[model samples]
Target: MQEWFVDVAEHIADGDPIYLACEECGQVALPPRTVCPDCAGRSLEQRPLSETATVTAETTIFSSTPRYAEETPYTIVIATFEEGVRLTGQLRGAETVERGEEVRLGVESDGDHWLITFTPSD
Candidate 1:
């Protein structure tokens, strides 16, 4: 994982999710960076992320390495927050979801690792 992702993980672990925002262009980045990818601006701020997001895309995984083989048929989702930040996370506690569905963003522990987690909000 990238070092910037660790910062996001830390915030998620603390129950305070955050994202990067370009102070110059107002572009939000989930996997954050020191410089804005959109405008190449150097001033970035860590901003709190919204609790809810809309599902933009989804996929079902049926095959994986041994570590996650048993968790086959799990759903992964790409969601976009109102701030225009997009993130990919595992959809938990829901068997199926649709594009445009609303989800609540969160973090969950999977064994010794922390993962981005999402659940149906509507």
Candidate 2:
């Protein structure tokens, strides 16, 4: 993985979810980059991601690799945070959600691996 990717994973694993916002263009980047993707600026700062998000898109998976076979019929969601950055994660502990539904951001860990999760807030 890219070093930046590891840095982001570590930050979230440490219980502080963060995103890099570009000072130049007001663009937020999750899984941060050293330079601003929108404006090619180098002034990016780490900011905490809001704990809540609104579902913007969703998909259901009926089949999967062995690791996730038991979790089939699961849903995935793309949620938009207050800062306007969108994050995609597995939606858990709730029925499939619609666009505009509220959800709580979370990180699910299986010791050696981690997955992002969004649970319905309502």
Candidate 3:
């Protein structure tokens, strides 16, 4: 899991689009993948992910999860990129966001490490 996080961090730093490549099936998947769901492959290649995406759905979480204690009652969105991959991340720059909103991906440093986030477009 740490290795995965490191890979994501490096990809964000390079400003390159992220993707996952399946070793067994040789399929390139965006948003990264632990395994090839199609072929049940265990080996995966992590690469940078795209920054542009559209909000497919969103909701505000009033209760905090164990990992996101500081982010209670925060808005989270499921964004679908042009590559047809979906990802969930923290939503920023707004008190309220809606479905179909165009957003861009960004990396946020949480003092120790970086995490993905969604920023609303102007």
Best by lDDT: 1
User: Which of the predicted structures, 1 or 2, would earn the higher TM-score when compared with the native?
Assistant: 1
lDDT of each: 0.85, 0.84, 0.76
Which scores higher on lDDT, 2 or 3? 2
lDDT of 3 at 25: 77
Q: Model 2 off-target regions past 4 Å?
A: 1-15
| Weakest ten-residue segment in model 3 by summed lDDT | 1-10
* Candidate with the greatest TM-score versus the true structure: 1
lDDT of 3 by residue, 1-84 (tens): 366666665676677757787877777665466778789798986644668789999989998868787768789889988766
TM-score of every model versus the real structure:
0.91, 0.88, 0.73
RMSD to true structure for each model, in Å: 1.5, 1.8, 3.3
Q: Give the clashing pairs for model 1.
A: none
Candidates 1 and 2, the one with greater lDDT: 1
Candidate 1 C-alpha lDDT tens digits along 24-113: 999887688767999999999988888889999999998877877888878999999998989899999899799999999888765457
Worst 10 residues of 1 by lDDT: 1-10
**Local accuracy of candidate 2 as per-residue lDDT tens digits, 1-122:** 35665566566667777888999999888767888989999999999878889999999999998989988989999999998788889998886898999998877667666677899987
